[model samples]
Structures are given as structure tokens and as C-alpha cells.
Target chain A: MNQRDPLKRVLYIDLSRKSFWIDDRVDLFERWLGGIGVAVQLFKEEAPKNIEPLSPENPVIFSIGPLTSLYPLASKTVALFKSPLTGNLGESHAGGRSAIAIRLAGYGAIIIKGASQLPLYLVIKEGEVEFRDGSALWGISNANTVGRILREAAIGRGIRTIMRIGKAGEKLVSYAAVITETYRHFGRLGLGAVLGSKKVKGIIIYGKHSIPIQDKKKYREIYDRLYRLAVGSDAMKRYHDLGTAINILPLNYIGALPTRNLNSSRFEGAEEICGENIAEKKLARRVACAHCPIACIHIASIREPYPDEPYFYKTTFISYDHELLYSLGSMLGVKKIDDVLRLIDTVEAMGLDAISTGVCLAWATEAYKRGIITINETLVELDWGNIDNYIQVIKYIVEQPNDFYGMLARGTREASKHYGGQEFALNFGGNEMPGYHTGYGAIIGYSIGSRHSHLDCAGYRVDQTIKEPPSPEEFVELLIKEEEWRQILNSLTICLFARSIYNVENIIEALKPLGYNYTEEELKKTGEEIYFEKQKLKLKLGFKPEELKIPSRVFETPTPHGLLKREYIEEALQHYIKLIEYKTLQ
Target chain B: MYVSSHEVKRLAILDAERCVGCQLCMFACSRRFGDGGLAKSAILVRSVGGIERGLTVIVCRACLDPPCARVCPTDALKLRKHGGVFLDQTKCIGCRNCVEACDIGAVFWDYETNKPIICVHCGYCSQFCHYKVLGVEKTI
Candidate 1:
């Protein structure tokens, strides 16, 4: 920790008091290494236990890392606050201009506490912050247009970050996401709703200041070496070529695509939704982060003909990813490219999480079939690859007209409980399942991983490697190591796909140019310490493994390998919990 | 290999309709400065809405007879024949006159240096533009 970067200055803004102050907790940044590490420490300090997530007492903590603006793919800014959805630790990371802007604006972190009486947006320039009225932007249904208006009004167009929530957040939907730069998002655990609770419409920030480097010459040398690897690597090639949608065919071929609410693992029309298909037929262009050479963001154009008007038409561009394809495409039985695009657009317009939205719709569809929620009670029919009806359902998820739809807005777990379809709720830790259906690693990782995210542990890779299912102990051990290493990667704030080209030694070398003096061993230990700290914070905040609910639907359907027994998953979860605890002790 | 000035240089123009707002060009531009951060970069990339609607990339187009240099109060902005304006930070004041003069708003200001950070069109940012979103073709 002696050779660590200077502590980032913390900016605390109290909406209730309409005041702001700075806190330079150097020790916290040096000890934890920023992002989740610092955020967790700050979260425990600011947001005490038993406070309502949407209350004035709750604090929303936004954090970035030391490597931000100094390294490629280290563009994600992590948000940590109590969840409006799970009533637990709600953390989401987004890549856009957010991380670079926050770092350049001269702060490592910002904590917003209390609630404003009226809707407002905060603008941070240089070292000063301003509170502006957002009455005009209030209740805007379209999230995409909001970003454009803010962009036009801001001093820095490309360099600044404009984070705003749409109707879903304004409505206080538990799955609402904070949209940044349009394409990137802090998409899960309802950070949008948390912002809405504070009556905060948006955050606009931009700055141009140099980050003090320890060794200028060495920093340049090391940075160039890693930069070349990131921009030129084979792993990054596909991302640049087609983005994340490329995983569709490969994942589908492996029988891990999760089609039709887990009833089948493979989608018959998987090729149509693959990255290659989108790139060839629909892909308009590729995009990247402020300091990232990996332009992995893919935008697709969907031109639709008017039903009645002649020669009058509108073209809508939509973003595609593996999760969106799995949830809205395969899970909902959507096959047509246009249909999938429309569904994704609807989700974004409503300011909802596409993965969760798709999963919720899937659950409702199955529930309707089982005589749970009647046809009249639901707004739209849940048919696979049905774009028009799915769009209507997405709108309802945000608006939540009747009691049934309102209950469903809370997420799959809450919706399933009320409607008696807990068996196939398709959620872990209150967040809906991601696209992966690889095996034990994916399930166990979702069940026990900190964020209940595929990225948290990425156990799917482990499952893909094993021909025979590993024993419960073996599976648990593999996930533990994966999660531990990932903790290090996240702390470094680099994208996980660069794991092949950049190892611990390479990362240390990369930082040497920036003037960080840490050996490979030191880096590993640092990663381990940060990982344990996050777990401890989660546990202290009341995260319990025994209390996790496993949806019954997964057990009934046979995955690609074979039928998944309830006992196997339970056994794996039990071992995984113990392993996590054991690692924390170490 | 000599090129004439009369022909238009087929530089990669960003069709905002196709943009995903990824900002990869921003990082590529920052890399040209041989530094790690967005502070020194000339290019800008940002999202429209959750990526589906696309992104916007902002950089100097190297305008012919650049207005940034013409309106400079302190002779800080200098126009080059090829395109773009070279900014002399030492001679300049932080007046932002050139920023207002340039119709495209390509004249960027570095807050820390209190000077304009215009694009030099060094072609290094093009190396990272693997998508071919940026092209550095010669004018005939």
C-alpha cells in the first residue's frame, strides 16, 4: 500500500441540505484501491443498516479506479448503494465517459445523500458542482433523446458523461438502469430508481486535468505495451468485429443458450441473433470508451415500413448483446431480427434492464400457460420471437397498470411468489439470470457471486472446459479461484476479455510506466485482500447463502448435458458458500 | 505519389446513424499523445441511448481555411494547408473566441492548460479505428 496512488478526493452532496463538501480519504483509496473496494468502505460508513433504499438517509456512492483514464478498457464507474430491488447490496458498473469524466473532474468518488423536493440535475465542471432545475426533462418517456439534449447543453460533448434515467426510474421500478452515453449503462439493481428517489434527473460532468503519475517515462513505456495488446489481440478482434452478440452461435451450439425460459438450452434460430448476423445484416458501426481502443460496442439499424402511410418511414437503430439476444430473442421466442431490435428498443425507452425485463416476461408467459395469471389480466401475449406484443409488455412492466403487472415489476422472484410460479422464477439474488446456461459454474456463480452476475465469476468458462460434471468440491474450488482472480482484474478496472494477453506480471509492468511499484505477488495479494473486503461488506450487510432461492423451473428441464437435479445444485451451492467463507478467512 | 489539392480527401466521416457511441476513437486519439488519459485527446466518443440508438464521435475535420485561426485574439490558432489549426498555448489567453468562431466546435479547450487542444490529424488515432470508421486518404 506504500506505493499506491494518492487517495481520490470524495465529493459528498446532500440534496436535502443543498450543499456539498470534499473528503480526501487517502488511506481508504490506498488500502482498498478504489471502485468496489472504496465504495464498499464508503457504503458501510454512509448507508447504515435498516435504512430504506429510497429514503433521504440512503447514500448513492459512485466510484472509479486509479487506472481510469490511464488505461484501456478501464472505463467502467461502479455504483454502490442499497438495492431498491433486493433490499441488499446494489452495485452496477458501466463503461462510457462516466469513469474518465469522474476521474478527470478531480474526484475518485462522489456520494449523493438526501432527497431534493423537486426534480433536479447536478453538473460538475472542474472542481465546482451546480444544481440545475430539470422540470422540463422530467417525465420524458424517451431515455435516448435526454442524452442528446444534455450533450447539446454541455461544455464537453464527447469527454463528459450524461447519466439519466427514463420513465422506468421515474416510476421507481426496481429494475431501472442509469443510462450513460446511450449505449453503456449501470444496468442492474435499480440505480436509476435510487436516482429517481432523490429526484435526481441526471448527472453531467466534464473536466480536463492531468492525473499525477509516479514515473512518467516508465508509465509511457508500460502503457504502450499493454495498449498494443488490447487493440491488437485476437480475443478483442471478435468484439470489435461483431461485439458480444458473437457469443450466440457458439453458446447455442454448446447447448447453453437458454431458450424459452430454460425449457430448451438451444435456440433453433440462434444464428439469426448471433453477432455475425447482426454485423453482416444490421450492424451500423462499432464504438468504444474514452480511453479504450477496444471498440466493442455494436449498433444495428432497423428500418421499418409504415403500415398506412406511403413512402413515409422511420429507421430505428438498436444495440444488441448476448444477454439481450438470450432474454428477449431466445427466451421470449423472438427470431426475426427486426422483432428482436424492436423489443430491445422498447426496453431502453422504458429505462428497464433488458435481461431482467425479458426474464420477467418469460416467467409471466409460463405462468399464463399454467393457469396462473389469466390472459385478460396480462397486457400482451408472451409468444417466442413476438416483437409487437413483447414491446407492449415492456411498456406495462414500467407503467404497471393492474395489480398483476405492478407485482411483476418488482422482478421474477416477487412476481413468481405472488402468482405461485416460484419453480421457474429464473433469478438469483433477486436479479434475473444472464444469458449463460453452461453448467454448474454458471448456476453456482449466479447463486453465490457478489453481484449474482455472469461477469462476477464467469463460471461458464469452467463448465465449458469440463467434459464430465465436476464433483461439488471441484466445482466450488474452480469458481472460488475464478472469482478471486476476477476481483483483481476488476480492481485493476480492465475489461475481463483482456485476461489472455495481460496477466498479473503484465499488469504490474503496465502500471510501472504510471509509476506504480508493485511486483506480481504484491498485485495478487492486493487483489485477494480487496476481494475479501467486498465479501465481508456483503456479509455484514446481511447477505446469507442459505437464504438464496433457486427457481424450480431449472430442475424440471434437461440442459444440453442432461437433466439437472435439485440435489446437485443445492450441494454445489453449499460447497460454494463454504469455499467463499474459507477464502475470506485466508 | 504527389496528391493535388483540388480533389476531396475521402476521410472517414461518422454517419451518426451508424454510431454506437463507444468512444473508441477518443482513446485512440489520447494514445496519439503517447499518454494514458482523455485530457490531451482530440477526438470524442459518446453514446446516444444505451448503445442501440448509436454513438457520436467528434474530432476536427481539418477544415479548409479554418476559421479558428482567423478569429484568434492572440494568434494562438494557426491554420495549416492540409486542415485543422495548431494552437500555441503560450501566446493564447483562455478567451474561447476560436471555440465560438469554429462552426463545427472542433476547437477544444484544455481546462488544465487553459488553451485550445485542436486535432493535428497525426493518423495515429486511425490505427486503433479498426472498424474503418476513420480513413486517412489523400486528396487528389
Candidate 2:
């Protein structure tokens, strides 16, 4: 409410002009708050209607909330961009130092626009922006190497975020990811390809500043309360114990695992890549974000025996979670945990979104099995669980040795469109599917949600737990409510892992000392507003509910619940449209 | 060493191996001084390279006869009872002499007002340290 609000200032950078400035948009922050709520408004203003996703006009908006750096688990940075993968509203959240750095760097949001003529990496430090030449760093295949080079070049340590792309982004793979802080990522919906289109290699932001709390005593009280709950809660405690990969065995046992391109929903080799196995066999270390007490980032030391040397082996460090395990392990029929780890490592190094890559490969393998194509088209044989051949295909996807590999690099939707296999492409709204195959909940959530992301709706929880099967209309209504509620989480950019602790009342209370006074009713209204605004943005961008593709494989596959019927899903979709229309009229 | 010290109540890295690099200590230290952020944090935790190798918890060693105090041109940093340096901010010119003189790089600069932020040997941060990597010990 005051002119001294440093957190309200949004840093704007124009790569084409090589110009940068800070815009004090206190009014926007006042009305929308920060993170996704503010980011969506900025994206609407910056990205022209129906702008090509890879065009210079598309904007990249990274935002953190007032709670950032002031509380535990307020540690996620929301990135909003037009997805090159989906061609719709794009949003992703990443942890590590991204939020902490941006918040401490003294900005509420950063909006980068326009493509540069030459390769450059923007460095923000000490209240200034410098476009460092990235010619030498370009074409370096590994994302880790890019992070390393940038880390050395960047001045500030302990409080800095280094975000960069790798071979996939450089090659304009539609599902490329932007790796941040080496082990974390803005990993979904082709944010990296969008950055690649701008000719920007990466961004390094570092600063030393503080957020001004309105009431220090109340702040400390709330901080300790939240910290205690965060560490003490049983449900939340599992995040650090086995990490999210703990879901593998349970999900597989329940028959909701989505193995081998959804030909089956359970995998036989679940234990090999399951959480307990990975933790006991390979866990190298556990790390946390700057302000978070939960060290959820689990890195594994994957040691592989050399082919030529009988006794020699090489160890590689790779971060793994449920999504990668599902996408690369069960989904691909990768029997060996080391094989899944190696594939994950390859995806990380190449900066490819593992979900899309695995889904694309799965679709290809199935397509090949049905004689949709031959070895002449795919230089390497497309076989399930064949790590050797899959590894070659992954490299081929990045390098694009042939037409099939090039189409596969684009993503599942495009690849299937070209070579046949539309029924089992397994992409929702043109973005690759996540690791959930619960039932209608996951299907409706992924197909009809704002970003077409499971996190947006998280209906898998509803599917896995609900005893009574609700009506199709009720299902649609529940998903809408779920998504609208998640607007608050993504808006605060809080990690969904801490959803139980970040209840609406707790959120409102958390905002008080951080200088935001919001009532429970007001927060709910704000969440609905953010949700509607994103839906409106997507509608403007040609995302049509009527045209939403429902993959038939989802219907054929028997989930933990039962067979998901196409007719039932369509009924839900129809109900969802009517509900949104009614909300719009109101 | 402080000329009149009887017992040293200084912060110690009791076990660096226990650190998960959450950096709650940084925010806790800053909060103790004033606000709830890292601007005033004197202690730091960073990965040795990647997080795979683990954390390097860097803090003022609370050196006996601290070089930061010796290099203070304005005598702004006086030796504390626990072997750390305490800054008299009114006397500090923001010349960064103490920041440069510290070999361990524990001296942090506050960018807003441009002053060297140093730990005063308080163990307020150790309370928030869930990993128990830090402690307040009475050392001889």
C-alpha cells in the first residue's frame, strides 16, 4: 500500500533491444497479489493475442509471492509462458534458489520479452542487468555444463538462480525443459524452446535484499508455527523420507501406474524402480531449497558397469521422482532401475521434459509393434525396455537423424499425427501426459484443466480415494472446484507438496505479517478470479473444449478403479463446458 | 581473544554432515536482527559444486583476535566476549575493510544500505536449524 514496496516492482527485459528496466506495478500486485495471479495479468499484457509460441512476441513471466523468503515452503517460482508444446497457456513451477533469489533480488516478478539477434545470457545482479555473450556456451549439449559455466561467471553465491537450456532447447524440441540450479527445473510445456526461440541461453539472477515484515513478532510466531507443522506433519514428512518416488509401488499395486504406453496400468518390475529400492540402493544425497526445511530433492548415484572393462564402472548423479519413474521406467517397460536412471540422466542432460520424451517413445514403440512403421523409418529399433536402442533413439530425437526422429522430437501429438497412433498418443491438450492413470479424475483433470497438467487439478487423489463414484456432472464440478482452489497454491507459487499445511485460513494468516491482509472469502474470490482469467486467456489462444482430444487408450485401459469409458469422459467434458459458461455468465 | 572473556559462548559447526542446506538459519539470523529475510543473514550454505556433493556451511569461526576487528579502520568492529566481532554501525563508514579482511568469507554485505553484516556470536539461528548442524558451545 506504500510507495516503499520493493516487492511490487517488476523487472522487464527486452532482449531484441538489449534493454532492461524495473516497472513499479504496485497496483497490479495490490489487486492480483503475486505469483500466478500477477503473472497471468502480466502475460495478458505482454503476449499479444494468438501470438506464435516460438515467436519473439511471446513473454516469459517468472513471479514469486509476498510469502517467499519469509516462510517455509513459500519457495516456488511460477513461470508463465505460451507453451511451445501445447500452443496454449503455459505455466510451470520450480524450486531450488529460483524463488528465493528473485525475492531477495528485490523484485516481485520478472517479464522477459522479444528475441535477441545473437545468443546471450541475461545476468541480473546488484540492481543492474547485463547481457553476457553466450556464443561459446551455445551448442554445449549438457544442461549441467551450462549451469556450471554460468555459475562460475556469475558473482553472487548462496543466493542466486541459474536457469539454462540444453540440446533439446537448442534443437527446438517442443517439450524441452529449462533446468535451474542444476538439479531443479521449470520442467514442462516447452519453456526451454520458447527461451531458445529468443536466442537467450540462460538467466542468472543474484541479489542481497530483505522483505519488510509489517509485524515482526507475529511474523516470527507464524514462522515457527508453520515450521513446526511442516516438520511435524506425517503426510508432509514422507516428501523427505522417500521423496515422491514412493508413489511407484503403491500406484502399481493399485493398478494405476500406466505401464508400457497404457497397455497395462501396472508394472511387474515396480520394485526395481520403486522408492524403497532406489533409496536403499542408490540415494546419494538429499537437498532442500533455500528457505524450505524439507529436503525433498533426492539425488541418486547411478553406477554403470563399463562394457569393455569387466571390473570398472562409472558413477553418475541423477535426481529422480515419481514422474520420471513412471514416465521412463514403468511407461517404457524399463526393467532395470539403472536403465531408468540412465534415461532420466540423459533427459536431464539434454534438457528434455522426461514425461513427454518417454510418452513419445512409448507411442513410437507401440506404433512400431503394430507395424505402423519399420526400422527403415526409425534408424534404431523401437522396442519396449530395450535401454540400448531407447538410448540411441533419445539421442536421435535430439540430433534428428531422420524424419521420424524429428517428428518424435516435436512431441507425441505431432509424431502420432505424422506416423499414425493417434488413439494412444497419450497427450492432453497437446501436452504430454503425466504419470497418473487413476480414472476419470486424471483424464478430466489433464484434458480440461487450465494448463492440462495433473497438478492443476490433482484429481488422481479423488480417483484413488473416493469410495462412492459420483455422477459425471458431479465429477466435472469437483474438478473445476479443485482447479479453482489450486489457483491459490499456484498463485502463491507454493509447492503443492505442502497443500495440507497451506490451507486457506493459514494462507490468509501467513499473508498478514507479510503486509497482505486478505480474508478467507477474499482469498477464495481471488483464486476464482485467477482461474477464470487463465481460462479466458486459453480461450483467446484457440484452446477449444469441443476440440479437446480424448485418447481411446485411456478408455480401454483398466485403472485401479475400472474401465474408463469414452462416452462417460465426453459426458463430463460436456458438463464442464456448461459449468464454465454458467460461471462466465455470473 | 577478548581480553576479559571467562567463557566463550560462540556458535559452532557441531556437525556439517547433518546440514541439508535448507538455509533456514540464514533467514532466522536475519529475522533476529530485524526482518524475516536474508539481507541481514551472516551465515551461508551452498553446495560444494552440485547438491550431490553436499553442503558447505560457511559462518564466522568466531576467531580469537579476529582479523575483521583488526582491519576495522574506524574501530567499528570490536572483539566480542565469545571471540566474534561486534559492529558499532554508527562508526562503520561502509568501506568494507572488515568484509575484505575476513579469510573465511563470512562477512556479508547488505546491498540496501551498503554495510557489512557480521554475526555477533548469538545462537538465535541454531534454534531454527532443524538439522542440528549448528550449536552454541562454551569453548575454552
Candidate 3:
């Protein structure tokens, strides 16, 4: 890393003390690169082991990378903290103006430590940090309203990012998310709860600093080439065209949709709520993260009439993608596109992780059907595809009106512990299951994954290619290889959608003009090191591979590769454990 | 070296609706001067209130009679045949008269140099705009 590069700066804010300081972390940046690599290192250094994830001791570290703002598609910001949801390593990536804002703000990472006694929001500008009273904004129900208020209240309109939590965060729902730029989020695991626990309502980052390049001509040449590839490539066309929601119909057809708590793998009404239908009917606009040419963020315009006024109507724009379409639509058996959008809107408003919320609701609805839970506990009928009841339940989850809703707020794993629905509760590593039932790869991948996210390593994609499942050793190797490479991509903080464009060669080429000269071999080694560092943290934080639960519902429901065998997943998981242990020992 | 006003080409927002708010044009503009980052970029694309509302591309509109040039007390900002102002760095007193004068907020400042960074109507940024939101048009 260049000594003069602002990316070498780390901003440490002690919320409890109301103090801020800048540390030149060239050693950390040069060694780990940036984003997840640097973030894991920061988390390990700052966060103590086995501490309560919601405690003020848990540090929330947000880090970007060298490629941010300088290159297209290097637009994601990685947030790392101890997850209140999983009680393990919590890591989430979000794209918007976050990476650009933080980078331009002249910091590679921001470590927010300690807890505030009173509610507050942080305004981080070019060289200053302001701790503002967030008492008025604290209990604001709608996340969008908070954004609106802050947008008006704060400066830096064009080059800024506003990351806030809603009622879910305020109430400390385990799956609560930190919404950034309204549409994007640090949306998985319990980053919001961590922020909520700290009494930090929101954070606004704005900066306008120029990055000096080592070789301007080389930088432009590489940039133009990448830009051409990004725009001209067919790999990114699907994302720009209909976005990830395009996976809905295809996944549904292959019987991997995981509908109604995995009671069935396929949704009959998948066509109605698929990407094509939504794009045709409701797609109001497409937006992009800063520096990304592929505007994959699809916002749907939902216009509805007010019940009180027959003539008056209001239009709402809600962002939707495949995960949302699956988790809120198919998982809940929501056939109507509007209902799915409405459910998504409700989830966003409350600032809950849509996947966890949907999966939790699916479990609750099943438990209700089985007479395990009743209307007395639910206060409303938990029915599949019932948007109104789901909406009410979503609110209750955040509000925690009862013991049942409180358990639901913790996520399905905890909800089922008392409710007698353990077998069907779709959670892996205590985090709610992502929308994939492809095969063993998906199950075992989630089981052993650092964050237990499908994005950790796309096991679902492996399921798509195989005629016969690979040996446990082979499968683990495949997963580990992809995941290791992904560490490099995540460190660059490039949008995973542009994975094809930023291959190893391109990544090396891209970093060259930025002053970091890395060989392919060194890059690969860095990836492995980053992955192992995260694994070590997860282990220290008390993640056990042998104890990972493979929901019985995954086996019961037929996947694209037919019914997945429990034995195969266990073998694969064991192989993964052995491999990771061997690597960690080294 | 004065060119005919009719032959002068200026960067234009061909279709503002096509902008996805990627701000690649902004980066491209900054990169044209041999650096990376938004500090040097004269073009600014921002959401119209919130992103859900859509985006507004703010750049030099190349007004027929530019307000930015007219307000330059130091005569640092010279009107180009293309209609946009050309900043003479040596002459710029760093007064920021042009920055406040532009109603559309097109004149951007380079804090490091303490001078105004204005677009010279170079089509470099337009080449990188995939959505066709930006282009170079002859003032004629």
C-alpha cells in the first residue's frame, strides 16, 4: 500500500468516550489487502472471544478496499462484528455509496467501539466526526423515514452514504439489518442488533478526496478495458436486464425454490412473482452502486389506493432481487406479485433481514398448522400466503409483544427449540437458511461456511452442474477453492456479480496501477490466509462443525438433484472440518 | 485559436432518465486529469431527493450565455465557443464567484488546488456512460 494513500488510514471512534482518532494502518492494509481480510484482522484484535454479540464490547468494523471508487464494480463495503443472530462471526457486504463514501472520506476502515448511553448518530465527513443526538430518530418506525429526515438534516447529497436501522434494530431483533442508501443493506446476521445495542441509530459518511495513481496511463488503460468488458460482457447482462430475480422461475422449475417452510421445493405460482413478470409490471427504475456499470438494483413501483380516500393513491418504490423474491415470495407461498412486494416493503420498513424474517414466518405458519402454536400466542392466524397476517407477525417480531414473537425475533433455530419444530426449522449455523435447496453442496456449504451464506461459496451453482455428486473430498476441495478465491474478490470488495470480469489476472492487473504489485501466487496465498483467519475467528467464537444442524426438511423436500442424503452432507462437512483444521494448524 | 461557436461541442445530458446513478461519468471525468476519485470531477450525478425518486445529472449545461463566466470577477472563467466556461488556473483567484453564480450548481471546486474544476466539454466521460445518459453535442 502507498504511504500517502488515504486507504491506509483507519478511523477509530470510541462512542462511549465520544472520541475519534485516525491510525495509519499501512501494515494491516499491505498484508491483508482490504475489506474482509483487513476487517477480520480488526475484529480479531478488537473483539474479545465468547462475548455477547449485543454487548458494547463487540466492535462493528466497516472496511472497503484499494479498488473502491477507482475501479468499476469495486463497490461493496464489508461490515464485520460478532453476530447476535448466529452467536458467531457476523459478516455482511452491502453496495451503494458506502464503499465510495468511506474511501473518499479518506479511510480504509472505521472501527466503532463502545456503547452510547443515549441514542446518537455519527456524521463522518472528510476530516471530522460528529456525534449527533438521535433521540428523535431512535424510535422512528420506518427506516426510509429516518433516511428522509437525515437526508434533509445532513449535508453531502451527491457523495454520501446513510446507514441506519429501523424498529427491528431499536428492539434488538437478532436478524435486524442496517439499511444503507435505502435500497441496499448490511442485511444478514445481526449487524443492526449490534448497532442497536451500541445505541447508535445511524451513520452518515461523506468525503471528496482524490486518489493519486502510480501510473495514470496504465490505470486508464486497465480501467477502460475493464469498463468495456463490464458493459459488453454477457455475464453481466442478466443482472442489468432483470437482476437476480431472474433466478426465480428457473429455480422453481428445478424444484429448488424451498416454498412454505420447505414443505415443497417448488412454488406453483412462481411465474406470477418471477423476475420477468415484475420487470414488466412493476419495475419503475434500476439503480447502481457507486462505480458499478451494472445497475442490478431493481426497484418496483407499487401504487395503491388509500382505503379512506377512494380517489387518493400513493406510489411506493421497493427494491427486489432473487433472495427477496424467494425468501418473501416463494418461502411464504405468496403467489401475488403485489403481495410479495408488500411483504418485502413491510420487512424493509422494519429493517429486518428478509430471509430470516421469511424463514421464521414459514416455521411459525407450519407450527400453527401442526397445532404447535396457536392464535392465542400468535394473536393472528399464521397462514401461508396471508400477507396481512404476515405483516402483523413481522411487526410483532420487532415489537416482541409476546414470548413467541420474542423467540421468533431470535430466528428459527431458537424459535424451534421451544416450539417443537426443530426438524423443519430452516436454519444453518443458527442463521436463517438462504433460498437454496439445490443439493448437498448447498446444505454442507452453508453448514461449514464462515458466514453460512450461499455467497460464502455458491454450492447451489455446483448442484446445477453435476450429474452425480462429487466425492466428499472433491466437493470440499471445490468449495474451499471457490471460497478462497472469493476471499480475494471480497477483499477487493468488488461486487460478486462482476466475478467473471475481475478474475485473478484482471485483479492483479487492476491493482498494479494502484501501486500494489502482486503476483498470482501471492494473491492466491493471501486469499487462503484471509479465509483461514476468518475460520480461526469463527472457531474462537465457538462455531462447531460437528454440531452444525442439517434441517430434516432439506432432506424431506426433493431438490434439483432429487432428495439429498444426510450421510453425504455429513461426510462432506467432516471433510471440510478436517481440511480447515489442517490448514489452521499450519 | 478561437473556434467557430457552431463547431464547438459540449457534453450534454442526452437523456437524464437513462442515468442509473452509477456516477461512472464522474469518475471518468476525474480520471481524465490523471488521478482517481471524485475530487477533480466536474460532473455530479445525484438522486433527486432519494434514489427511489430517480437521479439528476448535474454538469455544465453549456448555457448559451453562461452565468458562471459572467460572475468570474478575476476573469478566470472564460466562455468557450461551446458555451461552457474554461478555467484559466493562473488567473483564478480562488474567489469561488463562479461556484455560487451557477444556479444549477455545475461549477465544482478542487479544494487541493483551491481553484474551480470545470468541464472543458471533453467527450471522454460520455464514452464510459453505458446508459447513453451523457453525450457530446455540437452547440449549433
Which predicted model would earn the best DockQ? 3
lDDT of 3: 0.91
Q: Candidate 1, DockQ to 2 decimals?
A: 0.38
Rank by DockQ, highest first: 3, 2, 1
Model 1, B1-140: lDDT tens digits are 21232343434554545444445556556555555456676766644433444556667877777788888888988766566667776889889888898776566666657777787766666655645667566633
Best by TM-score: 3
- Candidate 3 per-residue C-alpha lDDT over A355-450 given as tens digits, one digit per residue, 9 for 90 to 100: 999999999999999999999889999889999999999999999989999888999999899888899999999988888888878887788778
**How well is each residue in A112-163 modelled by candidate 1, as lDDT tens digits?**
9999999999998766889988888888889987876777776765568889
Residue runs of model 1 more than 4 Å from their true location after superposition: A1-7, A580-586, B1-36, B42-90, B93-97, B118-140
Scored by CA lDDT, what does every candidate get?
A: 0.78, 0.87, 0.91
Task: Please write out the lDDT profile of model 2 over residues A129-220, one tens digit for every residue.
Answer: 99989999899978888888887897877789999999889888888999998889999999999999998899999977877777788988
State, as a TM-score between 0 and 1, how close model 1 is to the true structure: 0.91
* Model 1: per-residue Cα lDDT at residue A334: 84
As for lDDT, the candidate ahead, 1 or 3, is 3
Q: Which pairs of residues have clashing backbones in candidate 2?
A: B1-B65
DockQ of 3: 0.87
Model 3 TM-score, all chains together? 0.98
Ranking by lDDT: 3, 2, 1
Interface RMSD of 1: 3.7
**lDDT, residue A580, candidate 2:** 71
